[model samples]
Target: MKKDLWIGGEYRSAASYNELKNPYNLELLAKIGSASQEDVRLAISAAHQAKTMMVEMPAFERAEILEKVARFLRDDLDECARLIAMEAAKPLKAARAEVNRTIMTYTFAAHEARRIHGETVPMDAAPGGQGSLAFTVREPLGVIAAITPFNFPMNLVAHKVGPAIAAGNSVVLKPASQTPLSAYRIAEYFHTAGLPAGALNIVTGSGSKIGEVLKKDDRIKMITFTGSPEVGRYIREHSGLKRVTLELGSNSAVVVDEGVQLNKVIPRIVNGAFAYQGQVCISIQRIFVHESIIDEFTEQFVSETRKLKAGNPLEEDTDISAMITRGDVERTKQWVDEAINNGADLRLGGSAEEGIFQPTVLVNVPLNEKVSCEEVFAPVVHINSFRDFSEAIDLVNDSKYGLQAGIFTNDIHKALQAAKKLEVGGVMINEIPTFRVDQMPYGGVKMSGMGREGIKYAVEEMTELKLISFKTE
Candidate 1:
């Protein structure tokens, strides 16, 4: 199959092509048209030109169009999921779940369109302003440069594109090189839904080249990116006061208390730690278990991790699929070996076959080890026991990356305290740190990047506010 670059509402083939492959079996999936430097500049120009038309579009009409896009996605959910599974090597079930979430994301954007409201300011209340009336309105930023990552390609794209459209901004999307198929299909959906030409354009090519273009271009009003912290920092430095929403990496943690039933919490933790091979930003990597129940928790956790089947991603029953690449698998193995050499106990699988790294568990991991300190973005978890509740919270906050954290406890006081005290963006009580819905205020603190990404919040980030004042006698 050949997927073309979408620009100015027209699909055109590229002179250079980048062939996409299945991460699991190295099967050629599609030849993706690679956007040249000229093509990227054209996309940016098109988006800038189309900004007025998009902003002039009525909220109701935008809502209707996005709702149609959601319906189109629902009708083609199976095909979308299959594309995600093949290119990204996500398990079929997980891919379908991502499609479902993307549907909800667009649907939520549709709702947010009607509710993009602003507030009235009481300028008359100030001294010498008795007859002055002022109000603020939220208006769209002109052109948005949306750069998405490979993991959760469709949904993450929706999180950026949908909200940008809902807020009446034009977008030039650059999907991850590893999984542009899903992003291409989404562009087709928008085109089919009667979205105006150039409202949404997709440019696929080298991240360095394309990202540099997007960053340096003055016409792009905002750059919304989801990837590494290093790349996010680069964008920030070069963007020159342009708005940016960056959802970066993390080494998320979870606190398992003494009283919780190991049976119920074990499965959730296992799923959280290993789902999609733990490529997710908020995957539970650092687990601080209470010392009193550490032995029992480790035993149950390892047992559950061992039961996950590592096989072909297309298989319905497969729990653990191949990593994005052999290099990723090797890197994960190296981290595990380093941690083990530093005296961490390897409780479960650590070896890799082909490109598959079996879900691994480690215990007694030092806080300073690579697996404990760095973002081990693999199907791996490190469990360390904490003797006191304050110490558990301290251990969770010990990391430089504070995206999200979780706590398992029946005590309301403890749960509330964790919510207030955890040095992260969100604290999930009785749930894993990986828990996220499409419409929540989701972002992180510290090195987890800046701004938020829920439908409404993202809309706010994609727009600016203007205040109009009326001076009456």
Candidate 2:
């Protein structure tokens, strides 16, 4: 299939093109344009034109346009889901679910756009204003550069594009080169939905070239990126005087308190650790179990991990799929071997065959091991014993990545205490760290990221507040 860059509502060929391979079978899926610096500049210029048109669009009309786009997504759900599964190596069922969630995100943003209103402040209480009125309204932040990751390509793109368009801001999207097809489809839907030309642009290529251009461009007003922490830091360093919202990597933790039921908790933990081959930033990397239940939890967790079917993502029965690439698999194997060398006990599924690594669980993991400290974006889980809830909380908070952590506890006081003490963006009770809704404020606190990505919250981030003052004598 031929895939080209989308700029100003038209498909444009690039100076160079790259092949995208399916991770499951290592087959060439399609050839997509590798954007050049000139292409990036053209995209930014298109976004600037879109921004000018967006500000003039009536808020209700923008909401109507997004609503139409959501309808188009729902109509083409099956095709979109299949494209996501084929391109991103996501399981068929998970890909379908992701499409559903993406539709919901757009619909929610459409509804939110209608409700974006200003609040009036009574100025009579002010020191110098007796009969004056003050109010604050939100305006678009002009052009937004949306850089998305390969994992959850459809949903993450929706998280950025839905809000930017709903808030009346133009966006230049740089989808991961590995999975750019799904994003291109979304851009097509926007075009069909009557979005003005240049309202949304998609440029696919080497991240380094396009990312640097987007970061340094003065015309781009905001940068919304979802990727690794290393790249996020680079964007912050180079982006001058522009708003930035980064959703970076995480080494999220899950704590099992003594009062929790193991059978109920084990399945959730296993799913969180193994889903999408554990590529999710909020996927559970470390498990701090109460010493009383560590032995039993480890046994059950290993037994469950052994049951997962690691095979082709297109297969209906495959519970776990291949990693993003063979290199990722090799790196994960090395990390597992290094942890074992450091005295960590490999309890279950520590072998790698071809591109698919076995879902692994490591017990007696030392505190300083790479698997425990680093963001292992693979199908691996590290378990460490904690003497008490306080120690467990401390271990969970030890990482600079404060994305999301969970406490499996029935004790009300312990749950509340964890809510206060866990230095993370989200705290889940009686569950693993993988719980997320499309409406919640979903982002990290520290190195994990800056700012949030839910529909309402992202609209807030994509807009700027302007104060309007009125006086009557």
Provide TM-scores for the models: 0.99, 0.98
Residue-level lDDT of model 1, residues 1-473, one tens digit each, is: 88889999999878889888899999998888888888999999989989999999999989988999899989988888888999999999999999999999999999999999889998867798788888889999999999999999999999999999999999999999999988888888898888889999999988998988898889998999999999999998889989988999899999999899999999999999999999999999999999999999999999888889989888888888999989999999999999999899998988999899999999998889888899989999999999888899988998889899999998898888898889999899999999999999999988898999999999999889999989887
Model 2 lDDT on a 0 to 1 scale: 0.90
**RMSD, each candidate, Å?**
1.0, 1.0
Q: Give per-residue CA lDDT, model 2, range 381-423, as digits (tens).
A: 8999999788999999898799999998888999999999988
Q: What residue runs in model 2 are displaced by over 4 Å at the alpha carbon?
A: none
Model 1 off-target regions past 4 Å?
none
Task: Count clashing residue pairs in model 1.
Answer: 0
- lDDT, residue 118, model 2: 76
